[model samples]
Target: MGGPVERPVPEDSAPEQSAADVAPVTVGQGSVDSPSGVERHGMFGVAGSGDTSGFGGLVREPWTAPGAQRPYGSYFDEIVDGLYEAYADAAAAITKVVVERNELTLHIAREHLIGVATALRNDPSLRFELCSSVSGVDYLGSTHRLHSVAHLTSMTYRRRVRLEVSVSVDDPHLPSLTGLYPGTDWQERETYDMFGIIYDGHPSLTRILMPDDWDGHPQRKDYPLGGVPIQYKGATIPPPDERRAYK
Candidate 1:
């Protein structure tokens, strides 16, 4: 299963790449009625009338990386093809493939994240053996507000890819990748601690940064802004904007 698959010499290595080597990977046609990008209204995206930024008149269209078209350039096509070869159900597992800003991201269903990740890692052609980082994104107002993203590297092929999964806030659950990549243990915990994502199969998915009694996940887009009082060593401390005693 770990056999080495020859990589087409990248354009940089050779004067040019052959037509077959640069062929577009046709896996993962786009889905979802709406783009998964975040939508914003007003300068500060203010819900209430506190338009302190004063640029409130400006409205920004959601800039999203829509499902990518064929021939995802670079080694991306190879990676996609390899994943399909390794994973029997690649089509069902992946929601969409987004290649934008010179990067490739595979949005997988949360239920199939592990299997897809496994295929990426074990397949010699795909060889995304290392899960270097795991993090989260909260796209407020989207149907699936929480997104768990993982970055992987293929040491053998000098390639990298991103795997992302989204779940609704009401049921924010995703399988932990610690069993696959031990380093993901703390990264997943930190994501959970900051974003409140519950990693279902995590062995010890406790609060890694926030105190156990902390009121809410601090990093979520919907988390309250820092304007409340804080208790430190049994003494009251004013919020940042209200603080003036240091003078």
Candidate 2:
């Protein structure tokens, strides 16, 4: 009933592209077990058969055995709460003191890092004996932003906990815990090298791996994946997408 459609391109111009040039696609979640399983997603236009298990095999969850028994309310608990409360009262910028899954997590304003770390390390009852590890996680596309996770273990109380501190990419600065826990020296350096988190009080903040002239932090989520373009000497070298580097 309608009039015939007319082509707009001139004879010498490029051919008119069809809908196939930009086909609509369905996108499924990354997990194979999800109910909304089979769907195509992303710009590459790859389709999904909804199969995540390799070669039709089932995916097995890792085994976690039960742990040994430990005493309740170790001496740390007696004044731990009170000591933290005191520090929170003295420091206005300390944001939160949370105990979740038998672990203590502290959140503080970046500017108050020095005072808070000092309080936690020096507080007699809540004396966090050791700084086990310092690590940073880049959440480039995540809603919560970048989070720097610090793990601290108390040798005297034999308890372990994680302290999560966050800062925006625009202004990522926190006091170095090296002064409070000397063990943080190497760990902080690693975090700095990987995530570009600045430890304001760190003694030596330098690139531990890549050359100092490198432009960006390699471990950040937004960092580009880079590798040399390979030219095979004799045998065919499959492109990066087809080859399994690990194998």
Candidate 3:
């Protein structure tokens, strides 16, 4: 791989983020023999087989075909179907299914999260053994905003997929996956810290960074960058009227 991956700061045309509100990124040390595979944690990993059938350069599987009646049925077909079957009520919380970059995402409600996770993990076919990553995205002004996405990997087939779930600000109570994937502890805390999402069963939910007294979630678009009336060295500092303009 290249040099240590640096945390990416958005350009002037990108969404406005505070100097302090940088996205979290961890760089890995590794090398690649071929461009077709990606190295995870310094190990070369191959992409799944079914991921090849798509239009143009697009890789991920499409949700539905022209005449297919029973949803999508392929390598992930049984796994997804079994999940929805086992937890029909819990899975019903899922509002949408999106396929992008060879990943199957489940947009679910917060309340049914734990049940849905448990069902996914326990089911034989969809043995989503590891909860690879859990991160939150702030869709600020977008229609269905304030979303949290969880990426799960399966060791059995050496495949990877994504599951996305969302909740509004008023009720951001997602059932914690810490019990199922113990690693969720830190990710959940980070999500709570930056996005103010509530993980109901998180063993210990606290701010990973920033002072506990901080007023608002920095990741939120509506949250102001800094408080007014800057005072430095016991003197009122002059304010600049320079506002961010995008092209």
Candidate 4:
């Protein structure tokens, strides 16, 4: 009883954080954090030309942002709580939550899109009644290449949040949100046209920006650069939207 007894815990008995619980992040001194969990080889400069400038030799590895820690500042905590209270499978539905640049984004699984959307819209405390926009992105290097994003707005609470769902290019399908937010009809269509993300229950998933028989998604990273040339350097080019045959 001199002062206090200290004991050393065996390394085997001590608690250890598993890799699953770890959220990886890369922070630069004065640069923005991208927070995507994918790495890719990228060329910095000299597009379609030999490396005369040497800038093309450089590869940029953008920082990957970390998942939000507990007690997310501002009303993010309340929003999360409300979602948990409203959705029975909230834990499984919410794949990850990231707070960055003063915005809240919830990465949701595609399977639970409707359930989470319903909860966010109908639940009083988490009344995300409006989906301002629905967009698609191709994180080319990631396992899930296609990403569908919806920006939600709460008119009553004046809060805005984002929901993202990702799926592999081989099996790209997400349930439509037009049933919940009618405004997302054309937005989802445009996204489908641009990135080829098929909204499963969409009223009309036809291409909005391109012809019905358009070949591939124009905005995708792997899409060939074949569109009409706009006299960039007096270079003659062919159109990219060559009709594609559907099986």
Q: Extract clashing residue pairs from model 1.
A: 24-71
Query: How many residue pairs collide in each prediction?
Result: 1, 2, 1, 3
* Descending-lDDT candidate ranking: 1, 4, 3, 2
Clash count, predicted structure 2? 2
Worst 10 residues of 4 by lDDT: 24-33
- Give one digit per residue, the lDDT tens place, for model 3 in 25-127: 1111111000111112211122343423342243332122122234544455665676778676743445455554445666555445666676666555566
Compared with the true structure, what per-residue lDDT tens digits does model 4 show for residues 63-141? 5557899889998998999899988888877878889988999988766778888778877777776888889877776
The CA lDDT at 137 in model 2 is 75
RMSD (Cα, Å) of model 2: 23.3
lDDT of each: 0.73, 0.54, 0.57, 0.72
Model 2 TM: 0.58
Give lDDT: candidate 3, residue 84: 73
Task: Specify the highest-lDDT model's number.
Answer: 1
lDDT of 1 at 74: 88
Q: TM-score rank, highest first? A: 1, 4, 3, 2
Return the TM-score for candidate 3, rounded to 2 decimals.
0.61
Q: Which ten residues in a row have the lowest lDDT in candidate 3?
A: 25-34
Which ranges of candidate 1 are over 4 A from the true structure?
Answer: 1-56, 228-247
Give me the overall lDDT of model 2: 0.54
Better of 2 and 3 by lDDT: 3
